[model samples]
Target: MLLTLIYLIASVTFIVGLKMLSNPATARNGNLIAAGGMTIAILGTIFLYEEDGQKLGNYGWIFGGIAVGTLIGFLAAKKVKMTAMPEMVSLFNGMGGACAMLISIVEFDHLFNKDSGVNFEWTAYPPLSALTSDSFFISALPMGQLLIILLGLIIGTVSFTGSMIAWGKLNGKVKDFSFKNQQVLNILMLVLIVAAASYLLWYCNQVGVKINVLTGMDNTNLPTESFFTNVKIIFYGLFVLSILYGVFFVLPIGGADMPVVISLLNSFTGVAAACGGFLYDNKVMLTGGILVGAAGTLLTILMCKAMNRSLANVLIGSFGGNKATGGGGAGKDQGTYKEISITDTAVVMAYANKVFIVPGYGLAVAQAQHVCHELEKLLESKGVEVKYAIHPVAGRMPGHMNVLLAEADVPYEKLLEMEHANEEFSTTDVVLVLGANDVVNPAAKTDPSSPIYGMPILDVELAKNVIVNKRSMKPGYAGIENDLFFQPKTSMLFGDAKKVLQDLVGEIKNL
Candidate 1:
């Protein structure tokens, strides 16, 4: 009972910590609080619980597993480069998925091995003595929870693989936005797996874990079958199907929708964890899973909203949509394309009184956030006022650019949201547009023909001088041309984001 009180306190801390995380100002503190709660929970599991009460067998294996996992997790967290953040996130999500699925597998195993305390015998089974016996599942407990658990396992497994695929695509492990015949394969596999799971469930109900045989009128028994045996077979089949489903589900999704897909996959992992909690009646698992699931879902929805898209549309994999056909007319015509050499452009920027740095998805792709932050400090040293203009939906996900900047130890107050910075853009002597494209394009507000017309954008064009960095005249993730590139106020600094920034840094110092 005392241990239960300790568990309750730990759970409360987890809840309160999560609540604190909702605000950006408090997020770091919230993470620490949550970590403290988890520590307490782990300690309670290891030391406070009665030996017989805890069902987990073999303490040696448990301790060994914990040690190994902790070592790996710590190493990965410490050593992983910021460029590999997407992959790191996917790996974490996969671990969560595996944990959830393993819990479900244990439950399933218990149900088949009726000797376990986790299993409850069906009252429908025959025997006069059994009829008189009392048990938990004898009447009202909804067995639908088992089905939900299985579904969660399948979905979670798929989500895990999908997220990994997304990470690969982002990192160029696989080519970006390449279409394959993977959609058809996913649909077919989903149907077949669902049918198999359904059949297994139905078989369990009909046989009730008993050895059953078909009998003729003369009572001659045919071949007998055990429900448990079939369940083992079905389980292996489910595992295979899960792997295939994961691969296919992610194969068709393109770069534009990858962030949304990642969020959706995270939600799946949470739902799977919640299902495990429901299966085991573990309150902590339920609470943690529900919180993560809700947060991930909300983030996914918000990303979709920011893109002016629906979740369904993203899943269908349009992937930033097609590039706009025909040239950007009136806007392009209004401005004379002034191409300046890197040396000349750098000199102008170096002498600027004030420079507002605008970062976007490309900056993230190049893993240049830290470098950009360093550049800002260097400029500040030279008496330039450096502020960051942040768009609401900058980078691959909401708060993505902010996270990168924050990771670089940039002061939160130094970042200005769109509305706050838009009014000041005109007065800014130099606007350093770092690897950003569509998010800062004014076409969203001014052109009715633009695909992104309904979306809001940063007002980078209002600046007197704009220095744009790019590798090509190629469109952004949206595949749409940016009018800002052609503007007289803007000069293109074409190269790898990191290299260009480095060169600019050198040039600023030289000046």
Candidate 2:
């Protein structure tokens, strides 16, 4: 009863924490509250949970592993730069997947060995005289337990391998790998996985029947020990195949859709964890896993919508491998782009009645969020209405730009999403794009041939004057040149984002 109370408290806290995360203001406190609840659940399980009158032992090893893991996690979170935050998230998520996978593996081993102290014997019933005059009836394999184990093994392994691939891609350590008929191969492998699992379950059912019938018969009809050995081999084969399928599942996807893939893999891990919870009959673990699974699935769907791509296309299509050329007024570089001096750009922003700031991955790379905020304040002091335009998938990960701006104490109201920002662009006098390219590019709407053609973008071109700050004329992460750069109304301000923003702030002050 005490353990149940602890679990209830943990479940309530998890729900409240998830609700609080809907707004940025309470997210930190919400995270802390959730962590505290999890601590309570773990402590309750370690100290209070028991099975067959036996409590947990090996305290030293358990606590020692916990201490080492906590220390490494703390150091990693503290030291990782904001620019590499996506990679860190992927790494941490992979760790969660690994934990769930290991849990499933250990449980399977316990069940298969039987000598590991867990009883899994089947009960026999008397046979009906109509069916067999002198035969014994036996229960089939515990299908519920077998199904849960299979689910945990499949989803957990996929999450672990897929998340590792995502981490590598985000960190620039891995690239998209594809071969002819890859999609077909993936489908075939998936079918084989299902077939193998079904065969294993059937084998288990047959073995159970044989063992039960032999219990009531003479030794002459008993099955050989090699039958059990073959069952173990089938189990091992299923595990190995599932692992290979996971690798193949994620290997063909390009880097551009990594954010969505990460969310999907996160959901997979959550479901896998829920399987573990089911196996152990733990309410707190089940609640936590369901919450994560539901939230991650929703986030993945939202990301897919933002990109204007279907989930199937994201998984199977090679969209970001090569840059698209031509179409949407991007036929060759007919003319060089216009350049603006820092003083002139500052003058335009200061004189404007309203200004819009569009941020992107480069802003994070240059670590200029604070200085950008300083420039906003300076412009506001001159009676310029300043606001920021944030794309949904901006900066490597979802909400990444918002996090950076929040750190600089940017007001929540000033950060506008793509749809709202697009509506305000036409009424605005100046749009200062800070190291942003693809999100603000006009090609998305105008060029059907472009890789990011159907994706929604900020309508920065509608503003009277546009100033773009960039280090060079290089294409964006999609490897496509932005046609917006060559427009007559757009003036390029070439420099590092931090340095450029610092200079612009000084110029605005002098004006």
What lDDT does the true structure give each of the candidates?
0.74, 0.83
Cα lDDT tens digits for candidate 2, 262-316: 9899888888889988988888889999889999999999998888878987887
Kindly list the per-residue Cα lDDT of model 1 for residues 373-488, writing each as its tens digit.
88889888888888999887777666777889989999899899888999889889988887788788778887776666767777887788888887777777666677888777
For candidate 1, give the lDDT of residue 312.
78
Task: Give the poorly placed runs of model 2, Cα more than 4 Å off.
Answer: 114-120, 123-141, 210-224, 321-336, 506-511
Clashes of each: 0, 0
